[model samples]
Target: MQGKKFGTFAGVFTPSILTILGVIMYMRLGWVVGNAGLIGAIMIIVLAHVIAISTGLSVSSVATDKKIGAGGVYYILSRSMGIPIGGSIGIALYIGTALSIALYLIGFAESFNGYFGFGLTINDIRLTGTIALLTLTCLALISTSVAIKAQFFILAAIIISIVAIFFGNSNFQPETIQLFSSVDAVPLEVVFAIFFPAVTGFTAGIAMSGDLKDPKESIPKGTLLAIGTGLIIYIGVAVFLAFNVSSEVLRTDYNILMKIALFAPAVLAGIWGATLSSALGGILGGPRILQAMSIDNVTPKIFRKGRGKNNEPVNALFLVFVIAEAGILVGELDVIARVVSMFYLTAYGFINISYFLESWANPDFQPSFKIKSWIGLLGFMACFAVMFKLDMLAMLGAFAIIAGLYIWLQRKEVRLQSNDVWQSVWENVVNKGLKKIDANIDENLNWNPNIILFSGESKHQSYLLELGKTVSGRTGIVTNFKLILDKKNNKPLKKVDQIVRDDTFAELGIFARQVKVDNIYNGITNIATTYGFSGVEPNTIMMGWPKGLENSTEYSKMTETLLHLDYNLLYLDFDRKKKFGKYQTVDFWWRETDSKNAEMMLNIARFIIASPNWNKTKIRVLFVNNNNVNQEIISSKIRELVEDLRVLVDIEIINNAVEQKPFYTIIEEYSEKTDLTVVGIPNYKIEKQAEFVLKTNHLFETIGSTLLVKAANNFNVLDLDFIEIK
Candidate 1:
């Protein structure tokens, strides 16, 4: 899927057409100083090229990495620093895309007004902008493949118009060589302003670098080519206008291309074509950044949800258009442009800073293309220089948005971490701690062997009957049988609760009692903790070892909690009914070394042997030999300790005659005949060995036929709260 998509993107967005026109228009210079006066038009062109090369170099240096994503330059910058910085850059990129959309719409409206006397009011302009936005939105709603194809057509029209404009006006040159002299008419400030717009499209090509075939080679070539083409077009137009047309005519209107189009038939078509092409470009690129940001969790997840048939982020594209229409309503093109520049500048400044910092910190962080560190330094300065051009209110508004987002993210991250930590701490302090208290009380007071049955609405209910007949003390069964009603779903909680109650009552007859709780797992833990704290610990906690689902985190955590509370767990491993009258072979696998929690497993094993089923089952203890002298000594001690049970059970210690992995050997030899295998819980540690044992499939897979026993320090059997049987 990934390979196919890349192929399509590569074919459509390679920098072939864009490079030719990127530097030509000098829109910025024209906008600032209509004709560039006659003095600095040449200088402005030269300076624009210099700026273009430097900016392209900066971008390419970062783009060389194969890991670059849709966020393009911004993603690279943020990842190099950290999430906080990356998140800030992400916001800037989104704003930049949005502002570009607005700029395109403004240009679109102006050009349409010039060509067709639509007599658009401020509201009418806004409506038209909205319409344009919706059109683009629909285009974007289609798959990415369709959008790229559309861009190809837009590029084609732009190239054709540009070619005609230049060819048609070629014959209209001035006579005198002196006519080619530098324009003194254009002001430096005006020239700079005009040159700014030309630079806008240079970065447009780089925006799709993530979607490019090879960003490193492609971005540099495409960016340079685009800027070069744009430069030539701008200079040619400026030169033609300076000699053939008067400065008075240029000053009257900022649309030099449209003005030229009036006299020369070819120029008019080119003017319209360029405007439409630029507008389409904005539409094609904007929603992609939004989709990328959404996937990264910097924005709402819905924006990153499944794409429509056209492979576009339909929801995001719709949103961009809606916002663009709002911008058109205001009809303040300068405001929109400045804001756009401000956002891009902020993002670019950070990118430069991040690169500089990363280079300083890591010696290995070199790119294929090297820009003198000074270029990035200059890039930083350039961004700040442009940023200051924005009005105080706009700057303040931008800052406020950034600050608000940062605060919200920080709070959310803190809350999530805190919740996880609190859960862990609470389970240890209450559940495990209370069980110890119950154990101490039970030791002092004479109490019958209490049996706690964990059952649900399943076939495992027969164990309850067997326990009822054998146990001579207080017996209680617990199950997670409740209907949770969501108010948003418009379901009555009382009705839902009644249904659950009726169903559970019907299943268990009069013997079983249902306990209603908010969350099943937490409820069970809470009840067990309460009972243990009250000094009433059950002798045996009878529950089925829910087969096929032991790998789940919830089950593991619950099992760990039970082990920690020192509950003698009765894990009924019955998958189907078998002859109950005959005794079956039971295999016990015990490790040599004893840890602090080892007693929990041993106690549970003893309780299982004491069960009614134990009388019908033959128990065999198989001890694997550990070579470590100290471990072997501990195993010997454990062996002597269990010798008292030899009268009632068969015990054997396997010696290491052949050296091999103990776990593998034990499972290979005894698993075939064993009805049930018993193993001890692992001691939790931060070391690699412990982690390997916990995560590896060897133990889990081998112990499939076995019931795992983990020892706990603070838990007592009396605290067992049975939650479910099925």
Candidate 2:
């Protein structure tokens, strides 16, 4: 196996075929037939085979398209999807594969004990299983090549057993062979689930990909042939059992085939051989998955440690031993079967989806052995529905664990330097979206605050991204940019992409962008003007409050440049001392003279309320009327603003009766206690730049967390209220 490259037969055909005609076939098939009758059992077998074939076809297509490495399915997935998704699937596949050891060892012990033990206890059976596990683990650890050679004997045993089943005679007369056995039977889906693990062994050969001489050719050829051969054997055996064996015996005896065989000893040997071989397949396959993941930097580095000239994964093999023993501890064959089925079904579903998405999204996904993409889609849908039908909670738990692993991988800094179909998938989606938006550019549409912020460093400025997210809520988009000043970027493009990825706060959906720009203003201008196309363009720009007039001139000029670009501006003067304190009260400063600014300010507050963190927050429409001028009119105007805003908010007017002080003084005295305050920036104040900076800075100098908004339009909110209804 080390120096010589095995071809289709020894490499793929033997392992796959032997494993397919394995534990499930020997131990569980009779029980399945008894519960589901002849026709229903055939349907289950056929359905399971269909999924297996679809998945095999998918693996074949992808294998043909790329030069897969040691990880087999893990390698294919990591290359097709990102490492996170692939790693998650790989972990689950490894567990399922390792647990197959338990499933088979239990089956083996059951058959071995029943034949040899003159009425052995269940504990005795478990002990037999443990001994088998220990022996197999030692064999696998010593030499995988020797393990491959040993399968020859196992295959012969399986062949003899299969012959015995067909040629044997049983004295026990079976009841009428009903197409549909309607007597107290379990659900078809449950039987299907139990039987599905049988056909899932088709991937056994695939896991031996690294040792194959021509994986592209052998994989598809060997795998498809194995599936076809297994289907034939399963159908033949099911039909023969329906005719030759008693329904009562089939229902009661787990090893009914042994009783009705041409030679009971041959059938028993076949059961033992099949179970051992399948367990060995898992022992060989599961560790390699861990080795692959370890190599990919997802798992612990020690699992990648190999021994001998062939580079066997010694550490990973031992890890599989532990996991397998854990699975065996459950002791119930049916329970083990159900759990293994869920894991494999999830893997099969993802395999189908990976193929479907890759073929459709990418033109380079042309394989020599190309099949219909819809087959993969159909397989995915079928697996998904079947898993839920079998056991919704189990399926959900499996998926949840996968998701948990995915998230954990996502948070890790192990960036895989490989291309995935996701980029193409997103490109296809964006292309269609841009076309639609282009077609409807002239039509009036609802506004979404797609904001871009010049956040300095992601590690330090999470609060900025947080505020920006609140500004947009779930309906809007936020791109947090960190500009690295470098006229001539001496770093490689790959390193730059990595840097950007490192800077990104991807969990919040706001992937941070770190760009090397010669000039800050020019970079920002280019990004702002051309960052996005059609409706996704940044309509709003946000900046953190400048500290003590440092770079105030640059900040002011940048603000003016962007403001003139017709972009709505928000300057968050975040109070780190009181970070969104209490989320109790938010004050919206309302003024008729600067009504447009007021609308934007009010909307920002409303969007903040929409955030789960601030959903319970109450809004106050604060009207600053310090002079004793039109007190009643001011109250009515504030109420009208609330009505026009259409958001439920309390109105607070600070007239002469309430606070006999200047407007600026009154803001500090009354509004300083509010949680989040939205203040309007008027046009005239902005015209006088220095005064505007001084006054605005002075305004929020004593306030808590705050938003300073300047709307792009001179539109009246009072009038837009009527237009909103019409």
Candidate 3:
């Protein structure tokens, strides 16, 4: 089954014109002239239309380049600004359009009562509005084509109304023009609020974008035409009413259109047509917006259920009808108008902002029709300025509504893939930050770690990644390097292996990479020094403790190369088969009493505790008093250091092991129960090479996981020299 597609004239222009020549034009334009006069009303029309035109331009620019599906403004916005913003605007626009139905219905009911119900009560007006609402809604539900065809007759009636006004009014006296309402003489902002919706009706056509055969072409053409036509009509009405209608007649009698008409019945017909058409436009367009939003998962998908034979959004139409009837029952047309205006203005402001970002910042936003950045900026500023001036409470409420929707959608995390406007903004911000960092590269206090870790297969890779993340705290890039020795000639490692490794690391919230090289030693040396941007190169290299290092010289050569490059090297050894307990325990063994290892180990443990998995982990600052020299003094020293560093840890003095016992034996006996053990590797001279390797081998051979940390000159930790340990 194929859905009906509409062209520019029937799809865009007719609906747009009918909605534009709406209740505001017939009912409020004269009142606007009575208050703001010819010049003020013209200013209001021009200003409002400027926003509309700019938004139309922005819409056109974006629509032309992409195949706009459903969702209209929501679709365009979400696709351009990501789901959160788009969903927010979509919901606001939907409600605004839905409210418009009641707004128009009430206007029609008022005019109809004025013409026929000479002395009717408020109930009569509500009854009439309800009937009209149901009537138009039925027309809309029947099919969009039926509703659109009905707009043609409404269009004729509107033209006839305009003609009747021009021919019938003979009281032209430019000098007797009223500059303010004789009854109240309201503020300019209030008057602007009344007249602004006249131009906003163009979005009704925009909301029907999904049904349009060529939204890219139709939206720009039909929208601009409707805006231009509406502007002409409003300006003419302002001029006509200013020179002709008395200030008393304009202010006291809101139904000034019927009084000035050549045939009052034709004026009533025009009023009914305008209101009904506008109501129909809202009914037809509002549901489509909701349907599109639903399809995109911005709203409940149940709304996406009811597409009639003609592809009319049947479910969405019903939803819009219910809301509109509720508004009719309220019968507070003025308040609804202000709220509807506020939401439309807010939507326009975001549209302008989206365009401004696209034109000025986003390189991907290459539109066929170019819009100046200043135009979008001016539109954005004008919208909020007018909104706040018109009704600060309503403006704030509208923003609150949008904000609430934004937060809700963000929480939902609706995943839709598109190059959003924010991505460009973020990229520019990142570029600026990188440049600033590059310029301040020489400052030691400004240095942040950029770490590269040598990873093995999936099983061993996670350990290295976790430790790297612990040290880097995710602020710095932690790249997992897998160097595969090309033992089989021209037979590369399966790409799936690299993919699996990358995915596993990603699940742990880390980045990973695999490189096939002839040698792991040379690969590590080359990759570490040249892994990142100039100022952001890997300052630290992390790896799991190498197995059988006594049989290979790779570790010694790599350590020398790393030291020469001024990079801090850290190696971790952990029992992969072991499952850690709640409140993970970390044992930081202060072997050398040097600040380098003390700072590095403390920093790593600090980061680990920050993780949810290890948030309550207790740090044991174990002081091994092998010589049995002042155990109380050493415990006191560790306590002061822990307190000075502002870390919560228990100070333990290892008195069970004597100087004759191996350090590994002491570690195995004391720290085997803990989740992690941290020991600082002493800076080994060339003569103490065998001793250094032996110590590393013994530590790696321990039952618990161990981190062997060696800090460079760049690593900054708290100074213990100033603290007086009693």
Candidate 4:
């Protein structure tokens, strides 16, 4: 279902009625008490209009490019400057909303007391405030349609009251004209104080920008209309009060509007009706800002979720209500007005600054109504001028809140940018490089053994048995087995695999364990790279050498590629033994070469020695000598490096002169007892020897285990996962 947009007239009327009727009465009461002259009143009204116009322009400009969410000001600002700035604005907006809520509750309580003619205690006011807040919250939660409907109804009441107030003042005598001429009679401070409330409703208009269907057209028009309407009403009411009610009576009574309303029987109803309508607007508008802020990620996302039916930020609304009700419990009407005024002034000043900077920063973003940048500059100056009138604590508190928000946004932006930079580098360089290398090395092999089994159909079951045997003693491996099925073709195999899982567990019986199975549609390489990055490093990989296919070029290439992977690639050859004995003998074939190459050999040997499975085995080091004069020197150097091994190390220095296929002779001698053979080559390239090693195929067909290491002069063993002799 689509949401209803704010109509043109409503867009203007809501803010207009909210601004004038909401707090103008309270402002006037303060002014009457302060005795601010005509000039002070005029200054306040002019300053307010300037502020209204500036805010309207800035807000409308933002609204034109983006959808205004419930997080009103914060959302618009955040969209303009990005999240960090948006967050600061959001927090400030929330604080302002909270303060406004509190102020309204205070006003509600004071007005209730004045009308009821009772000596209501703070607790009584608090109770009524809580009930009123809860009612508003309930209304907010119902639906946006309902809320807007309520807004329209309240605005109607406000308009009716304003009209009545204007009509009631038609009987103004000559004394009223004389009162206007006696401008010096009222003190300048009092008039300024009274006029401040007249401007309070401007923000209420600004807050409605999010809901307006055509904020660009409606917001500026509505804001100006609201301001104009508010001005007329405030001036009319103020003049009527000044003439009808005596200065002494108005001075002593803060509810001078209510008293003057009594003079004309119908005017009292309008005054009370306006008060209620204003309170309703305050309650309705404040939560939307909070919700918008949350949606922008400036606040918790939970608050942004809002109610499904209402599309309202119920959590934010409820929070506002609670805070406002609490403020009502502790504050009087004066404190509420002061705190609210202080917050609005500070926020409004920033609004002007934001607009000014935005205008200067992006001159292309011209508004429909372009006040000279100096107007905003002067508007901010005027805001600060009136801000000094606030108490020291209120001023400090307001600035402190804004300062905290700025610091928070700065920190947030730094972290956000740092994360973005890191992600870009990883994606553009690290991930890209690894993927390219992987693609070149083995496009067919699935390095990841976590999900997809690496071997073809004939070897799958045997490989599974080998995996089960390998992890027999390890408890941690029980739940880690993953069986990946090809989604496109393995529907039957998936069911069979599930059965295999059950049968395997049944066979294990008491050792019955858990295994994970995933059905995937992609090829092996994609699966491998995906899991490799996902942190699933398989301990052992098992596969089968195809019968009568071992000598095939394809088989050789596959074996060579698998060897390069550096994992324990156990080939389930039918000719090989299926099980291991208690003690195993391993052969370590070392060649005398440069000190650096020798170190690489030693590091590989040490890695084997540290292995839990291989450390207990006896290791034989066969140092082949091609009658090089420096053979002893190289042997001695290797001996020095291998001195720390606890296992028995046998070093055989075979003379190169008597060699009849050196690798063949060595393997024939050691193949009977050796479980594994590790060989090392000379660091420097020997062209004749290299060709012989590559073409002869002398040791290539050997049945026993063999590893041919092509040593480089400056090799770091730690960097190479596996050495490939290609």
Candidate 5:
């Protein structure tokens, strides 16, 4: 049962034709012709169809190129514009379609009230409309085929009525066609508003895109054919009304078709059938849109379920029925018609804009059916022009609703399968920028750190990424790399591991990779040197503190080699569990004047303080008492240095004796109150292995989380001349 699907005629043309030749044709076309005259009415039809046909061309071009699934216009727009804009417009279209059901039902009720209610109340008319809405909704729930088959009978009644009116006329008076209404000439824009909706039901077919067997082939053919057919019918009706009816009668009676028909009964039947068929079309199309949005997770997930053996969207159909019945209570057909028109026109405008942007900016948007970009632009402009003239406040309200929905959906972060068109747009922009940068690649005053961070294992490394992002400012590249020593396996990165690592890095919006090699040192050296673009190569290497002194020699060797290659090194020993207290302090230890690490540490702390998490972090400069050094002189020098640098920090003089206790204990005691500490690595010396081992162990045991730095002296020291006594 699920295998059966709708082809072009039953799925697309039938609904499109039924909706286009609906209540407006039988009930309102004569009124439009009466007010606007023959030429003005024709102009209105042509302008409305121009927007419809142009939008159809764009829809066709995109439909032919991709496998368009459910969501119809929503699918097309979302796939082209991304989920946020697409979802918002889809919601508006859904509401429009829902209201369309109500509009058709009220039209049916009004005609029913007029024909059968000589002595009945308006409430009775509402009951009949309610009954009709329920019957059609049940048919829609049972099968789309049921409602579609009902349209055949409706179509037959309409044809007989049209034949009676056109051929049954004895005389065609061409001179009776007035340029303006005999009573009062309605504005051309107002007439266009009333007439424009006639051309819009063509998209009702597109709403059933999910049920069609081949939407790509059916949507374009059936939609365009419907538009062309509606245009011809409207033109013929406008001409017939102009010549056959007196301008005074046309202006006075909106139901002039019934009064002039050879068989008044058949004409009455045509009005009822046209209204019912259009209601059927809405019932059939609106639910499918809700179902598609549900499937895409834009709507609630429960709506994704269907009850029928053929997977008909019965739940969504019920939802549409409830909304239509509510609309039946209001029961004002003309006002409902105008409100529905605003939503439809806005949707049409967005559809054209999506296609225009695709054609102009996205090189990947290759469609088999090509449409000129200007047609889309023109269609988009025309839709808004007519919309504002119809009702400015209503149009603004509709736009506000769509924009609000877009903001809400963006915050929800709904994910879809379509590729982001923004990526292609950005790619083109960046390509042009790169070409411009090639000519002046070596200009001075451009400094960005392309970093290669050594991630030993993938556990608890989120802070590493945070620091990388903090320093890079999202302008430079930071790659988290893991090196495996076993080289035998061809694909050393396990799928599960890659997925876990990717998910971790994706949260921080960073890049991560793993490389397997015979030696870890060789892997690090190779990747760091050859990782990034020329003139933007990896200028920095960052690593966490080593586990013990056992790997110090190898690490020192790596540092020397990296420094020789003009790369700066940063070593961090921070714990992820630490939280910032009310009084946040960053302790910086100055070892000597030659330690360029002083400048690098201060710069990094400044970056940290700029972040929201560490916004109030205070910096404190600390130094141990040296041989015969005066504490007052040192404290005064630190003050002078802080004043010169124009930064706020505390100057601490530590009096702990290094000979009495381990250097780690003294440093830890002095820095116990601080949140994070900054220390510099002493210059590498091959003759002092024991001393290096002792210092490495003691420093790693400092009170708080610490950062170890070894600057390559690639930058000048901060000016300290003011700190020197005059």
Candidate 6:
């Protein structure tokens, strides 16, 4: 494994071509021609090769584009597509390759018994296969290069056998050829599945990419040549069988080619050679895949161990032997063939997907042998369709197994030291979506709050970010900017962004950002005026409640600036001493003049209850009606609004005109035991912050944790879920 020994022909083409013209050609081609006539069989041949050639193109494109890591397809995919998906597919490819050994041996044993057995049965074939697996496993454990040397002789036998079969005499059968066969044979899809494994050997070379002198040049050249060579031989044999042999005989005899060849011994030698060579190829390839997976921590560490100076994967080879033995015990070539086909198809599909996404996502991916991304997509689609056609239940079960493995790998956090395409893909999607969206949205019909946080209190940053998430209700976004009051105005914006860009703040759709300013008041004003885009701009400014009357004047001025910009102001009066006790009750105080605030407050209340802590908490809408309105009438009006908003609330209407207790007094009596209370800031003159703060401070003293909301627009209360009041 450590030596630079193989050139293009020995490394890639010889092994690949040997496997492609293998067990299926000797044992199953006549059956396929019988089940589907000449035209139908040719269609199957062409269709299967389309996937192969497409996958080949994708493989070439990826291989030539970059310097893929060692470990063949596994390394290429893990580097290009990320590890979890790569490991999932890599494991499948290894199993497929290992199980294929059993399939070839089963064919060999059947052919051997037909030529020399004294009326032996399936049991005899199984015995022969076990012997063959042991012999091949020993050869592999001894020296892998011996297997490569053997393939040259195997290739010669296969060519001679093809020549013998072509010249062999068959019973006159000009009338046997038909466009389609009778329903007596198995379904067309079944025939296709049985024949599908023949084309899969095209990738046999890709698994040995690490051994190539220049994989970039050798891989594409050798792989494409093998596929082309296999295609010509396959279609030639299919047409010959259709025209020379009678359909009834073709249907009945699995080894009709070997029986009717010009020199039966030569054909038998070819059959033996093809089957053994393919098994040998699998033996040589499967362990390498497992070994790669082990070294990458995708599998256990023990399988990564090797023997001798060449570092042969002796442990992984034993595992392959075990799986191949189990496959042999299954004792049905068609069953084994179908399993092999499904596995190969699954891996091939993902390979194309990886290539397709990588080409589009990575702008630097310019391959000398570039193929259209549509070709890769086409390959993916064809594989998917063929898998379902082969066996619907089997296809679903295979996908489920692969998906389960992928999930397990993800949980293990299989980190590869490479970049994946997801970030670029997501950015492209977002950029396209943003460019396509209109700036002006119908506010009443479809809107969600985009909150901008400019809080002065650093200790409550996490709380404010979480609150933004809760209020957005998954339909909006949040941006938290920790305003660093740099009176010197010395910090650059690059470092400013770095200031608040902690990984923790970006959770739950919040964008963590920072800015430097001379004062909190001017910073909020300038940032709010400039932040965000036109369509999804920030319409709400969230800030912690002012701590003392010392800065009430500046806070009041900032509040006026936001109001003038037509933005809603939500001041969180979070009580650290009694932080949102039990989240049991939400009281939204309402009045006629505070109708707009009532809408925003109701939206916030709905968002609060959606949180896990408050999901079961009920909303209690408490209205203080001052116009001497009838209690029941006010209750019905508010009830209609809540019902239209599709939310549940207990309506409590108090006719303050009858017993006009102060607003703070009413809160002290009813909301003293509540977990959270919502109130609105009354409209006042810009210079009257001292008067406003004095009353608001007392209200907070009377209530528990509270949100003081002031809306700048008269938005409909019923459309709180959709509308944004900016």
Can you tell me which runs of candidate 4 are displaced by over 4 Å?
Answer: 26-34, 65-67, 81-85, 117-119, 167-187, 243-246, 259-268, 333-337, 389-393, 414-726
Specify the poorest-scoring 10-residue window by lDDT in model 3: 717-726
Work out the TM-score per prediction.
Answer: 0.51, 0.79, 0.76, 0.52, 0.70, 0.88
Count of residue pairs whose backbone atoms collide, per candidate: 36, 1, 0, 13, 0, 1
lDDT of 3 by residue, 1-726 (tens): 767788888888888888888777777787778777667778888888888888877777777766788778888889888999999989988998888788878777877777675445678878998888888887777777888888888889889988998878645344577654445677777788777777887777888888888788898888888888887888888887878877656655677777778987777788788888888888988988899899888888889876655567888888998899888888877776777889889888888888888877687777777767788888889889888888999998888999999999999999787778788988887888888878877734533567787767665666667667766764767777768788552765576666434466777666677767767788798787677785566788888777666445676777788888888777877677663434478888876445766766666766777777778788888766555556677767667766655678888777643456666777888887778788777677655666777767766565577777787887665443322433
| Residue 593 local lDDT, model 2 | 54
Summed over model 1, clashes come to: 36
Tens-place lDDT per residue, model 4, 504-584, is 544532122222324321232233333344223433334433345434454444444433543333333322452233326
- Candidate 1 is scored at a TM of 0.51
Worst 10 residues of 2 by lDDT: 717-726
lDDT of 3: 0.77
Model 6, 521-543: lDDT tens per residue? 89889989998885577888887
- Provide the global lDDT of candidate 5 against the true structure: 0.76
Candidate 1, lDDT over the whole model: 0.53
* Best by the lDDT measure: 6
For model 6, where is the 10-residue window of minimal lDDT?
717-726
TM-score between model 5 and native: 0.70
Best by TM-score: 6
The alpha-carbon lDDT assigned to residue 436 of candidate 6 equals 64
Ranked by lDDT from best down, the candidates are 6, 2, 3, 5, 1, 4
**Residue 356 miss distance in model 2 (angstroms):** 3.1
Residues 153-256 of candidate 5: C-alpha lDDT, one tens digit per residue: 88789889888788655343545567664446777777777777788888888888878898889999988988888889889988888888866666677777
Per-residue lDDT value at 335 in model 4: 60
Which residue runs does candidate 6 get wrong by more than 4 Å? 118-127, 134-146, 172-176, 300-315, 329-340, 438-445, 454-465, 481-536, 564-566, 629-644, 658-664, 712-726
